[model samples]
Target: MFPLVFLTVIALDQLTKHLVRGGMALGESIPAEGFLRLVHIQNTGAAFGILDDARPWLIAVSSIALVIIIWLAISRRIGFLDNIWGRLTLGFIAGGTLGNLIDRAYYGYVTDFLKAGIWPAFNIADASMVIGMTILVFLYLRSEYPRSQ
Candidate 1:
Protein backbone atom coordinates (compact mmCIF):
# COMPACT_ATOMS: atom_id res chain seq x y z
CA MET A 1 0.00 0.00 0.00
CA PHE A 2 2.79 2.38 0.88
CA PRO A 3 4.66 1.52 -2.28
CA LEU A 4 1.56 1.90 -4.37
CA VAL A 5 0.68 5.34 -3.02
CA PHE A 6 4.29 6.52 -3.16
CA LEU A 7 4.77 5.36 -6.73
CA THR A 8 1.47 6.84 -7.86
CA VAL A 9 2.26 10.23 -6.39
CA ILE A 10 5.77 10.23 -7.80
CA ALA A 11 4.53 9.28 -11.24
CA LEU A 12 1.92 11.99 -11.19
CA ASP A 13 4.39 14.58 -9.97
CA GLN A 14 6.98 13.71 -12.59
CA LEU A 15 4.48 13.54 -15.41
CA THR A 16 2.95 16.92 -14.58
CA LYS A 17 6.31 18.62 -14.24
CA HIS A 18 7.55 17.10 -17.46
CA LEU A 19 4.55 18.28 -19.41
CA VAL A 20 4.71 21.77 -17.89
CA ARG A 21 8.38 22.13 -18.63
CA GLY A 22 7.94 20.92 -22.15
CA GLY A 23 4.94 23.10 -22.87
CA MET A 24 5.82 26.41 -21.29
CA ALA A 25 8.84 28.64 -21.36
CA LEU A 26 10.26 29.97 -18.13
CA GLY A 27 8.17 32.78 -16.61
CA GLU A 28 5.37 32.04 -19.05
CA SER A 29 1.81 31.91 -17.74
CA ILE A 30 -1.18 30.40 -19.45
CA PRO A 31 -4.32 31.45 -17.70
CA ALA A 32 -6.49 28.45 -16.97
CA GLU A 33 -9.32 30.44 -15.41
CA GLY A 34 -10.14 33.49 -13.35
CA PHE A 35 -7.00 33.70 -11.26
CA LEU A 36 -5.43 30.40 -11.93
CA ARG A 37 -2.64 29.76 -14.39
CA LEU A 38 -0.04 27.29 -15.55
CA VAL A 39 3.16 29.17 -14.99
CA HIS A 40 6.47 27.51 -15.67
CA ILE A 41 9.52 28.40 -13.62
CA GLN A 42 12.45 26.59 -12.11
CA ASN A 43 12.84 27.18 -8.40
CA THR A 44 16.26 26.79 -6.86
CA GLY A 45 15.06 27.21 -3.34
CA ALA A 46 12.30 26.17 -0.92
CA ALA A 47 8.74 27.36 -0.55
CA PHE A 48 7.81 31.01 -1.06
CA GLY A 49 11.07 31.31 -3.04
CA ILE A 50 13.11 31.46 0.15
CA LEU A 51 16.85 30.99 -0.24
CA ASP A 52 16.48 31.68 -3.90
CA ASP A 53 20.03 30.68 -4.60
CA ALA A 54 20.42 27.93 -2.03
CA ARG A 55 20.24 24.79 -4.05
CA PRO A 56 22.87 23.05 -1.95
CA TRP A 57 21.01 23.67 1.29
CA LEU A 58 17.74 22.55 -0.23
CA ILE A 59 19.34 19.34 -1.42
CA ALA A 60 20.88 18.61 1.95
CA VAL A 61 17.68 19.26 3.89
CA SER A 62 15.56 17.21 1.53
CA SER A 63 18.10 14.40 1.69
CA ILE A 64 17.75 14.33 5.45
CA ALA A 65 13.98 14.21 5.17
CA LEU A 66 14.22 11.36 2.69
CA VAL A 67 16.42 9.41 5.05
CA ILE A 68 14.00 9.85 7.96
CA ILE A 69 11.07 8.87 5.78
CA ILE A 70 12.91 5.78 4.60
CA TRP A 71 13.79 4.85 8.14
CA LEU A 72 10.17 5.19 9.22
CA ALA A 73 9.10 3.06 6.30
CA ILE A 74 11.50 0.34 7.31
CA SER A 75 11.11 0.43 11.07
CA ARG A 76 7.41 1.11 11.06
CA ARG A 77 8.05 3.04 14.24
CA ILE A 78 5.24 5.17 15.67
CA GLY A 79 2.98 2.86 13.74
CA PHE A 80 3.98 4.60 10.58
CA LEU A 81 1.91 3.42 7.65
CA ASP A 82 -0.25 1.46 10.07
CA ASN A 83 -3.43 2.75 8.54
CA ILE A 84 -4.61 3.77 5.10
CA TRP A 85 -4.38 7.45 6.04
CA GLY A 86 -0.90 6.93 7.37
CA ARG A 87 0.17 5.24 4.17
CA LEU A 88 -1.26 8.03 2.06
CA THR A 89 0.31 10.74 4.18
CA LEU A 90 3.76 9.22 4.14
CA GLY A 91 3.39 8.48 0.49
CA PHE A 92 2.86 12.16 -0.28
CA ILE A 93 5.84 13.20 1.78
CA ALA A 94 8.06 10.55 0.28
CA GLY A 95 7.01 11.33 -3.24
CA GLY A 96 7.30 15.08 -2.80
CA THR A 97 10.72 14.82 -1.22
CA LEU A 98 11.95 12.52 -3.95
CA GLY A 99 10.48 14.66 -6.70
CA ASN A 100 12.35 17.73 -5.59
CA LEU A 101 15.39 15.70 -4.74
CA ILE A 102 15.48 14.40 -8.30
CA ASP A 103 15.35 17.93 -9.68
CA ARG A 104 18.07 19.08 -7.31
CA ALA A 105 20.36 16.23 -8.26
CA TYR A 106 19.70 16.37 -11.99
CA TYR A 107 18.87 20.00 -12.79
CA GLY A 108 19.98 21.74 -9.60
CA TYR A 109 16.47 23.12 -9.16
CA VAL A 110 12.82 22.14 -8.89
CA THR A 111 10.38 23.11 -11.57
CA ASP A 112 7.14 24.74 -10.43
CA PHE A 113 4.29 25.61 -12.74
CA LEU A 114 0.96 25.87 -10.94
CA LYS A 115 0.00 29.45 -10.14
CA ALA A 116 -2.91 31.05 -8.39
CA GLY A 117 -2.88 34.80 -8.67
CA ILE A 118 -1.43 35.84 -5.32
CA TRP A 119 0.08 32.54 -4.33
CA PRO A 120 3.63 31.65 -5.18
CA ALA A 121 4.09 29.23 -8.02
CA PHE A 122 4.25 25.57 -7.05
CA ASN A 123 3.93 22.09 -8.49
CA ILE A 124 2.39 18.78 -7.64
CA ALA A 125 5.21 17.87 -5.29
CA ASP A 126 4.65 20.94 -3.20
CA ALA A 127 0.95 20.30 -3.14
CA SER A 128 1.54 16.76 -2.07
CA MET A 129 3.78 17.84 0.77
CA VAL A 130 1.26 20.36 2.03
CA ILE A 131 -1.55 17.87 1.80
CA GLY A 132 0.42 15.16 3.53
CA MET A 133 1.46 17.44 6.33
CA THR A 134 -2.12 18.56 6.86
CA ILE A 135 -3.39 15.04 7.03
CA LEU A 136 -0.61 14.02 9.40
CA VAL A 137 -1.42 16.83 11.75
CA PHE A 138 -5.11 16.04 11.63
CA LEU A 139 -4.51 12.39 12.33
CA TYR A 140 -2.33 13.18 15.29
CA LEU A 141 -4.85 15.55 16.74
CA ARG A 142 -7.71 13.20 16.19
CA SER A 143 -5.83 10.45 17.93
CA GLU A 144 -4.92 12.67 20.85
CA TYR A 145 -8.31 14.15 21.41
CA PRO A 146 -11.78 12.87 20.91
CA ARG A 147 -14.40 15.37 19.83
CA SER A 148 -16.91 16.23 22.50
CA GLN A 149 -20.51 15.98 21.45
Candidate 2:
Protein backbone atom coordinates (compact mmCIF):
# COMPACT_ATOMS: atom_id res chain seq x y z
CA MET A 1 0.00 0.00 0.00
CA PHE A 2 2.81 2.37 0.90
CA PRO A 3 4.73 1.63 -2.25
CA LEU A 4 1.59 1.90 -4.33
CA VAL A 5 0.66 5.32 -2.96
CA PHE A 6 4.24 6.56 -3.05
CA LEU A 7 4.83 5.55 -6.66
CA THR A 8 1.45 6.82 -7.72
CA VAL A 9 2.07 10.25 -6.25
CA ILE A 10 5.48 10.52 -7.83
CA ALA A 11 4.26 9.33 -11.20
CA LEU A 12 1.28 11.69 -11.24
CA ASP A 13 3.33 14.63 -10.12
CA GLN A 14 6.06 14.16 -12.69
CA LEU A 15 3.64 13.36 -15.47
CA THR A 16 1.58 16.49 -14.84
CA LYS A 17 4.65 18.65 -14.69
CA HIS A 18 5.94 17.14 -17.90
CA LEU A 19 2.68 17.76 -19.68
CA VAL A 20 2.53 21.36 -18.53
CA ARG A 21 6.10 22.03 -19.56
CA GLY A 22 5.61 20.48 -22.97
CA GLY A 23 2.35 22.24 -23.73
CA MET A 24 2.73 25.63 -22.12
CA ALA A 25 5.33 28.31 -22.44
CA LEU A 26 6.96 29.61 -19.31
CA GLY A 27 4.89 32.32 -17.62
CA GLU A 28 1.98 31.50 -19.86
CA SER A 29 -1.37 31.30 -18.13
CA ILE A 30 -4.80 30.08 -19.11
CA PRO A 31 -7.38 31.70 -16.92
CA ALA A 32 -10.53 29.79 -16.21
CA GLU A 33 -13.95 31.34 -16.22
CA GLY A 34 -14.14 30.68 -12.53
CA PHE A 35 -11.49 30.29 -9.81
CA LEU A 36 -9.03 27.87 -11.34
CA ARG A 37 -6.23 28.63 -13.73
CA LEU A 38 -3.25 26.87 -15.24
CA VAL A 39 -0.05 28.81 -15.23
CA HIS A 40 3.45 27.79 -16.18
CA ILE A 41 5.62 29.09 -13.42
CA GLN A 42 8.85 27.80 -11.93
CA ASN A 43 9.43 28.15 -8.22
CA THR A 44 13.03 28.22 -7.14
CA GLY A 45 12.35 27.75 -3.50
CA ALA A 46 10.06 25.99 -1.05
CA ALA A 47 6.34 26.63 -0.69
CA PHE A 48 5.06 29.93 -2.01
CA GLY A 49 8.48 30.62 -3.51
CA ILE A 50 10.10 31.39 -0.21
CA LEU A 51 13.93 31.20 -0.05
CA ASP A 52 14.23 31.70 -3.74
CA ASP A 53 17.96 32.13 -3.47
CA ALA A 54 18.54 28.94 -1.51
CA ARG A 55 18.07 26.12 -3.96
CA PRO A 56 20.90 24.03 -2.52
CA TRP A 57 19.64 24.54 1.01
CA LEU A 58 16.13 23.60 -0.03
CA ILE A 59 17.39 20.46 -1.72
CA ALA A 60 19.34 19.45 1.36
CA VAL A 61 16.35 20.04 3.60
CA SER A 62 14.07 18.08 1.31
CA SER A 63 16.52 15.18 1.18
CA ILE A 64 16.76 15.13 4.95
CA ALA A 65 12.99 15.15 5.31
CA LEU A 66 12.64 12.30 2.83
CA VAL A 67 15.17 10.26 4.78
CA ILE A 68 13.47 10.90 8.11
CA ILE A 69 10.04 9.96 6.81
CA ILE A 70 11.36 6.81 5.18
CA TRP A 71 13.15 5.92 8.41
CA LEU A 72 10.02 6.47 10.47
CA ALA A 73 7.94 4.27 8.20
CA ILE A 74 10.50 1.48 8.08
CA SER A 75 11.45 1.62 11.74
CA ARG A 76 7.84 1.47 12.89
CA ARG A 77 8.85 3.79 15.69
CA ILE A 78 5.45 5.45 15.45
CA GLY A 79 2.53 3.31 16.48
CA PHE A 80 0.05 5.02 14.18
CA LEU A 81 1.96 3.85 11.13
CA ASP A 82 0.94 0.30 11.94
CA ASN A 83 -2.27 1.14 10.16
CA ILE A 84 -2.73 1.40 6.41
CA TRP A 85 -3.78 5.04 6.53
CA GLY A 86 -0.67 6.03 8.44
CA ARG A 87 1.51 4.22 5.95
CA LEU A 88 -0.32 5.89 3.09
CA THR A 89 0.28 9.30 4.65
CA LEU A 90 3.97 8.62 4.93
CA GLY A 91 4.00 7.43 1.34
CA PHE A 92 2.41 10.69 0.26
CA ILE A 93 5.00 12.71 2.09
CA ALA A 94 7.91 10.69 0.78
CA GLY A 95 6.66 10.72 -2.78
CA GLY A 96 5.94 14.44 -2.70
CA THR A 97 9.34 15.23 -1.26
CA LEU A 98 11.04 13.13 -3.90
CA GLY A 99 9.00 14.74 -6.65
CA ASN A 100 10.05 18.25 -5.72
CA LEU A 101 13.60 17.17 -5.02
CA ILE A 102 13.89 15.72 -8.49
CA ASP A 103 12.77 18.98 -10.00
CA ARG A 104 15.18 21.03 -7.91
CA ALA A 105 18.04 18.75 -8.82
CA TYR A 106 17.35 18.61 -12.52
CA TYR A 107 15.79 21.98 -13.30
CA GLY A 108 16.95 24.14 -10.38
CA TYR A 109 13.30 24.94 -9.80
CA VAL A 110 9.95 23.27 -9.25
CA THR A 111 7.42 23.48 -12.01
CA ASP A 112 4.08 24.77 -10.77
CA PHE A 113 0.97 25.01 -12.89
CA LEU A 114 -2.25 24.74 -10.92
CA LYS A 115 -3.48 28.05 -9.64
CA ALA A 116 -6.49 29.27 -7.74
CA GLY A 117 -7.46 32.83 -7.00
CA ILE A 118 -5.15 34.53 -4.50
CA TRP A 119 -3.32 31.32 -3.69
CA PRO A 120 0.26 30.82 -4.76
CA ALA A 121 0.57 28.57 -7.75
CA PHE A 122 1.46 25.03 -6.76
CA ASN A 123 2.07 21.65 -8.36
CA ILE A 124 0.83 18.15 -7.68
CA ALA A 125 3.79 17.47 -5.40
CA ASP A 126 2.90 20.41 -3.20
CA ALA A 127 -0.72 19.29 -3.02
CA SER A 128 0.33 15.78 -2.04
CA MET A 129 2.65 17.05 0.64
CA VAL A 130 -0.02 19.26 2.14
CA ILE A 131 -2.64 16.54 2.08
CA GLY A 132 -0.33 13.95 3.62
CA MET A 133 0.90 16.24 6.35
CA THR A 134 -2.63 17.34 7.17
CA ILE A 135 -3.75 13.75 7.65
CA LEU A 136 -0.71 12.89 9.72
CA VAL A 137 -1.37 15.82 12.03
CA PHE A 138 -4.97 14.72 12.46
CA LEU A 139 -3.84 11.22 13.33
CA TYR A 140 -1.41 12.53 15.91
CA LEU A 141 -3.93 14.79 17.53
CA ARG A 142 -6.53 12.11 17.62
CA SER A 143 -4.16 9.76 19.37
CA GLU A 144 -3.14 12.34 21.93
CA TYR A 145 -6.62 13.48 22.81
CA PRO A 146 -8.23 12.00 25.91
CA ARG A 147 -11.32 10.00 25.06
CA SER A 148 -14.25 10.41 27.42
CA GLN A 149 -16.53 7.62 28.57
Worst 10 residues of 1 by lDDT: 140-149
Model 1 / residue 16 / CA error / Å: 1.2
Best by TM-score: 2
Candidate 1 global lDDT: 0.84
- RMSD per candidate (Å) reads 3.2, 2.5
Candidate 2: tens digits of C-alpha lDDT, residues 1-149: 77888899999999999999999999988864448999999999889888996989999999999999989888888776668889999999999999999999999999999999899999989999999999998887787433432
Each candidate's number of clashing pairs is 0, 0
- lDDT digits (tens) for residues 1-149 of candidate 1: 66887888789989998998888888887874558888898988889989988888888999999889867766667553567888778888998889888888888889998888899989888998999899888887777334432
How high is each candidate's TM-score?
0.90, 0.93
- Poorest lDDT segment (10 consecutive residues) of candidate 2: 140-149
Record all residue pairs in model 2 with backbone atoms less than 3 Å apart, i.e. clashing: none
- What's the lDDT for residue 31 in model 1? 70
lDDT of model 2 at residue 6?
88
As a TM-score, model 1 comes out at 0.90
Stretches off by above 4 angstroms in model 2 are 32-34, 144-149
